[model samples]
Target chain A: MDISGADLVRAAAFIGAGIAMGLGAIGPGVGEGFVGGKACEAIGRNPDEAGLLTRTMLVAQAVAESTGIYSLVVALLLIFVV
Target chain B: MDMVFDTVSIVKAGQFLGAGISIGFGAIGAAFGEGLVGGFANCSIGRRIGMASPYTRTMLIGQAVAETSGIFALMVSVLLVFGDFSANGVCAWTATLSAGICMGLGALGSGVGAGYPALEAIWGAARQPAVGGQMTTTMLIGQAVCQTPAIFSLVIAFMLMFRNCVGLDVWPYGASLLGAGIAMGFGAIGSGWGGGQAGGAACEGAARQPHLRGPLTTLMLVGQAVAQTPAIFALLVAIMLISIGPTEGTILTSAAVLGAGISVGFGAIGSGMGNGITAEGACNAISRESSTTKDMLTFMLVGQAVGQTPVIFSLVVALMLMFITFNIPATLVGFCALLAAGISMGLGAIGSGWGNGATGAAACKAVAMEPTQRPVILTLMLVGQAVAQTPAIFALLVAFILMFGNYTGPVTLPAAMALLAAGISMGFGAIGPGIGNGITAAAACEAVGNRPEERGLYMRTMLVAQAVAQSTAIYALVIAFVLIFVV
Candidate 1:
């Protein structure tokens, strides 16, 4: 069967969208992991400062996750909007 | 009725199916990765230390963040698979592939990279138990660098699949695809290796001297982040290629892509090496004298950040290449822009790296001699480093102009020369600041180490002095930007 221009274009769009969402998540995911890992380590070492460590970890992780969220938005827009 | 149903059915189904598959798989992968790391970190810590570890929850929470991308991908895929959406050919493929790579690789990096730093931090804590604050900071910074590749991948994937600014035909699609892959792959390599090295150094420092943990950790993070900047820049450029496309009117797109890749790759090398050195120095300082750790760490970080400025600038130039459209008469503009930006950053990196290193060493020495004046010493060190950063910033500003500004009208040779001069000015201008700031930081470190009680006053003074030193560099950037954009 002959592939029309439209089909190819449609296919490209789908692939691109998938890539953006997939790749964007990597940084935040990894970042959060590190933050979590450190927090755990800290808490274990000094249970008294658990509150501070947890707070800092959460704040930093949130910042790291921002980019991932941006990527996700883009992916959804691609899949649903155009 | 049958014809209409047939016409819409296939496209709608395909869209929905594709979205669902993409997000569902992405989420699953991320979740699985986070779960494994979180569980491992918690269990390992529990067994090694004790059952009542507050860190267990925090570790899981951090791990959960890493899972966000997976969740995001899942949501997008579900939306695409289930929803009715308009389809653009290039946009669809770019999006899917970009997302897939981002989440899949991101999960892998975050899981492993985060775990490595966490393990180090735990060991540090176990040893000192007092300097936990400093150890955590250092670990976070290293982890952030490790996460760079993942972030870069995600940015590109998202832009390709979701943003779809450049119609497929605009670029040599094959090159773009290859570029995207290279960007993420190289980025991961740089961050992963760099972070590990820096984190290890920080952990060792914390373990050796619990009191000096804060400063030592800060130095480690700064150095690592600087080292990772180049890789991040490359990723940004690759993403820009999709949106900016190659313009026939100006520089060839191929050159831009190649240049961008080279700049970031090279930048990564310098940053990594520089960071490693800084970390070593900080570690040594901490071991010798824990009391003066904070001052020494601050000085080291400031210097390292300055050293990495060139790489950051290079990334900005690459980004400009990918996004900016310039209408200039000369064919050499694109080549010059790319070359100048790359070379500028490369050269600037050398000066800042050495300068910061010297400053860090000095601070270390000063702190070792006089631990009481730590605060004053740190303030001075930061000022010196800030000044040292001027040249790199200048290079970045000039490169920005060449890449982004529109120079269309017929201008005299003098004007062209002026524009070129602008770049040169910033490049050289950075030298004074670099050396000046380094000296200032050294002195401040010494002061703080001698009179810790006067830390507040000394820090304020150093900040003011550094700001003044940075003015010249800021001026150079403004001028270059103006030359490129305004005149």
Candidate 2:
């Protein structure tokens, strides 16, 4: 099948965007899971310290999730801007 | 929509494939690594509820560190997905794919390796809540070192995706860049794993035996450092590949590029892991046998140095692959042979690295076991390790033939397939002996540790056994050479 060069590039960009975010989410997902798990364990052990543990866990998870966010932004840009 | 019809060819396919691969592969190690750290952190928290604040804080910081590699990977993917490579033609497209492979795969090692220490630290802190600060410090330091490979990958990826590669025209040169990226990306894995293994072991040792903390830290650091050697070699090879590109695309240059990539990428894996294993072993040995710590450390270093043999051979093969310009007739089979030669050598190096690492670690433990038998154990370990390197050498020989040897007559499709098969035969064939040699080294170490006086006998026996092992690698090499002449 004869495919146009520009069309191929455009399609590649869209697919690339999807992959960028989809794959990018992986790092944050795993990273967030880690912090969440640890926080849960901490809270379980010292219920009294749950507040502090939860705070730390959330903060850590937030940071870990940041990469995913960055990826999303890139993906969006790929779809829209690029 | 209009652009799609206007465009003529599917040249951008590599870019899309590369972008997908980059993002997909890049995120994996980071996520898995985070999981490891987080799982341990949770377990540790459960054990020490009171230290939640400190442990949680540290856990967050560690996870943050682990995310860097992923971030780098993301950057490359975004660049690949968004960037304009249409004007650059095949060279640009191939480079994009290499960049994706480099960053995506490169992130795998450091992202995972860094998390290991974080994991161990969280677990260690739970057990020893008082040393949370120290744990964090140590873990971060180890993670920082482990991140080198990823960083190197990033720099190269950025260069590939952004720059025009310093005017190295033609797809063959771009193909070399591809090889360099592959080398850097895959090479980091074993080293990263090795570093994590050492760092995690250190954290555990320090927590369980506070008195041996100093020694454990030293051993862990040293091991991590040693584990990085092969990756460093891969990096060097990569850099060399990048700088020295062929002026024009040729069957020989394209093949060389493939060879260069495999030579470094696969070459680093076995040794890197083996090095980590050594460090972990040393950490364990030092904690139990602190008195012989120095002597044991010396033995570990010696073994690690020896373990680098395959990597060295790989580097040599990579260098030869790049510099030696064999003007083979332009045929698909000839092209395949070039890549096959490189891949075979690179993969074969894994066995050497694996064997060397196992031997080194076992030797370190043996040193701890029989302090007086240091000389004997060291000797036996070295001998066994040498035997283990035969397969790597065989692979290297095949690589040399593929690079330098002149094939007779016009190349045909079957001939090219035979050459590719030859390369595959050698590449896959060498892995067994490489691993087998490690087992032999470990066994020899164990024998010496158990009976230091019987070192001579063990060495002799191992040599005999190793000779048997070498035969396989030899046969593969012979087959590859035959393919070179016949195929």
Candidate 3:
């Protein structure tokens, strides 16, 4: 029932780490989805430029995914390292 | 070790719970926000307006804003669970309330703030489908501005849950929290309203003449971004308030707040005046030669971006206030530094604004006289305005170091004087380059218009000359940095 101050703080930090990772994922996920959808549409419209569209989409999606990855790392750290 | 484990576990659990709540709520908010924008994009309005592409992009951005709150909440939750919140002496209630207030209010502003621009972009696209590309740029710039408030809120929330510098027990924790919130709140309002106005104007312009859409949109976005710079700075200041803890007296704390307000407020003035002038120039150019709208718009926006640098510098100053502590011996020196930095930014604003405005005006006139010489004229204008930006950049660098970098005490009066001199140099240094660059741009524009055949030679010569003109500003910057950091 009773808890030590140190334990409480540690627990708080763990939760914080999780929060950083979890919430961070939302932006990139949506951003990547948008890019992917747009790329697909572009490819469909101009199959000849499929390569170009795919490349651009991939590049953009990668950028979009960065934050999500950051979130993931933070989450992992919280669970294991932190 | 056992005791440590026990303490850490409790905190970790709280952290997890907080993180869950933050991200969960943020996700919900983001989803709803995106859905609204997406729905609009896919709805009859979007179809009628012909902004199907931009509409989708806006929806995604809106979702990003909505999701931030959840992240803030989640971060708070995790901090609660894992972090040593107790050692820092942050009352659990304080931490909780701060987190809640930050996420709740922050998310509210971000959601609405981001949405406004999307709506405007949609409307603009609908009215002038031909200028969709330009409209999209304007929309993004405006949206970025609108996001400032939310960003500010996020920064504050993060500080509360993670940094908690207030544990230093320097100032009343409550005041610090309230102050941080207020700083962010006001910043959001300013950026949101300013960006919205600019976006609205761009939309209206695009609708009126589809041919002029490209240049007009670029002009609007640049203007909006410049306008948003101060708000960004304000947010930075709010972050500082929470992270720096507090000063001894109420007066000093209030002074810090007032200084931040002034910095942002003055920054707004510069952005407003500069954006107005640039926009007007763009409008006139678009009217004269609609076909070359794209090049003209790009040049105008680039010019405005240069013009916005001074305001950005002020924001940097505000951020410094949060981290750098001023003692009695250093109080006067620090105050002067802050004031001088602010004034420097303001002065830099005047130079860049006028310089860029003149260039914009010249570009417009040239395009009017010889529409075929658009490329050459645009190139000249951009080069000139870029040169004009040097002094402002110099001031910014000086201000940044004075605020953030470690400084030796003003041991001797001469040393203190050197600081003051450096500040003065930065302020005055901006004027010459700004005015000179403008004149050169105007000349280049006229020359291109007069002899289109000589456009290539004229542009090359103009760029070379502009680079030479920028040298003096660079010198001033080097000198200022030396005085502040090296000396």
Candidate 4:
């Protein structure tokens, strides 16, 4: 039952890392899918805009994915540094 | 086993945990609901400068009703913090802690759900001032139904707090009490939120078609009742767990009992919310196409039935866990595996159920737009729903493997941790993909409905997008497998 301060800190950091990535992934996962869905709809309406729409969709997804990336970075930091 | 725990100390600790959990979780729903009501009331006032007084009054009443569940949570928390516990034992400690959890989680759904109706009611009032009074009545009725799940939680919490647990074996009974609380708490969340969504949609519908107010109300009631089915299942499970008297104090039995609660509790959440979303879509569709109210109702029922499949799977797993006994090591590894199995199944079902509901909602609106394409739309919706369910199916597979697997290796701490981590990884990993794929399917359904001639093109697009969305679930599955086998 004996535990040091480092042990407690390490345990908290691990849990925090898990939570950070888990919650963070949710927003981007849903957001990117939404962006892709809209692009599909637009492309369906006019095949002429398919290339441009696909490019735009990629950009939107990348932007949406930023937060998830940030979360991953934070998680890594928590695991490695914190 | 080395530590000594006195009755007073344990009781005090339980009370503190209970009070904190009760207020913390309970405040979430009420605050969300009240804030929504205020926001919408302001919007309504701005829209209808003349009817500001009536709208304000309606907003206040709605906020008041939504606050009831939060108040209930607060009361339970206060009682836990200050009330004297005459009953001392393991039961006293578990009961107090469980009661806090039950009240807190229970209030969360009702509070948020209650707000939806109020906000919509105000918005409706602004749109159709002529039927403002009728809309207010509808909002109240909807909010009342939304509170039923919360009341169920409150009852369970009260029972847990006051129950006689004298001479009961600590392990099984304590775990059972805790499970009962978890089951009731998480179970109420979805039903409350879903019921509110349906109520809000109905209020908006009433404003759209004032003449059909009675029928709209009827539809809302039916939808709300269907949406509450998961919560009802949870209540049944909670009651069953609560009624289980002192059993043999085995760690294995304790794990199974707790697993049952976790399974049904988390399992009920998605189905309840999914059913509500389907009902919301149906209400909106009927309002748009008054001529097709009959068709819309039938479609909504079918969609909701399909949407409940994930919860049904969860219920089956829970029942099995509760009733069936399996021979395994009574060690921590075995306990973790059994518990993780429930966790995997319960969390896995959430995303699929929610996604299916979204797809159903889209299909419902599409059906209203193109009644001629009803069969086609239904087929597409089902396909989307089925695809969305892959993550749940994967979760179920992982759960089955974990529960039934024969391990010849040493029952070490890493093995236990890996088993738990596998479940955690899969359970959460499935959520995003399920919802993401559903979003893709929903868009596809709408697109096809708008352009029936291009059904094939839309279908292809939907499948492609869904496949991409599902990749994340696949990755999670891989991680889970690696944890189970490699780690």
- Judged by DockQ cut-offs, the docking class of candidate 4 is acceptable
For residues B353-402, could you state the per-residue lDDT of candidate 3 as single tens digits?
55565666666667766886666777777776676566566666665555
Docking class for model 1 is: incorrect
Compared with the true structure, all predictions reach lDDT values of 0.51, 0.72, 0.53, 0.82
Q: Please, what are the lDDT tens digits per residue for candidate 2 over residues B1-487?
A: 3655211133366677788888898899888888888888788778878777877888889898889989988888887777677565446766778888988888898888888889888887777666767777778877888888788888888777664644456467877778878988898888877888888778777776777877787778778888988888878877776676665867667777778878878888888888888888888778667888777777788888878878878887787777776666666756876787787788778877887788788788778888888777777777777777777887887777776556665544545555665666577657765775576567667667766655655565455445544544554565556555742
Candidate 3, residue B402: Cα displacement in angstroms equals 3.0
Quote the B-chain TM-score, candidate 2: 0.89
Error of 1 at B72 (Å): 6.7
Off by over 4 Å in 3: A1-82, B1-271, B293-299, B324-331, B364-375, B404-418, B456-487
Better of 1 and 3 by TM-score: 1
What is the Å distance of residue B156 in model 1 from its true position?
3.8
TM-score of chain B of 1: 0.48
Cα lDDT tens digits for candidate 4, B340-390: 888888888888888888888888888888889998999999998899888
Task: Identify the superior model by lDDT, candidate 3 or candidate 4.
Answer: 4
Ranking by lDDT: 4, 2, 3, 1
Model 1 lDDT tens row, B1-487 = 4554342354354455545554544555355545544665565476556623645644554455455545555655555555443355433443454444444443343334444455556555555556555556656665565565555555665554454333443234533543453444334433444454566566667666665556656666666665565556656666655555453433346445544544454444445444445555566666677665556656566556655655665566556555554454444444444544544444344335444554565566656766654555555565656655555655665565555656554444333433443444344434444444444444445445554554554454444444444444444454445434443
Leading candidate by lDDT: 4
Q: How many backbone clashes does candidate 3 have?
A: 53
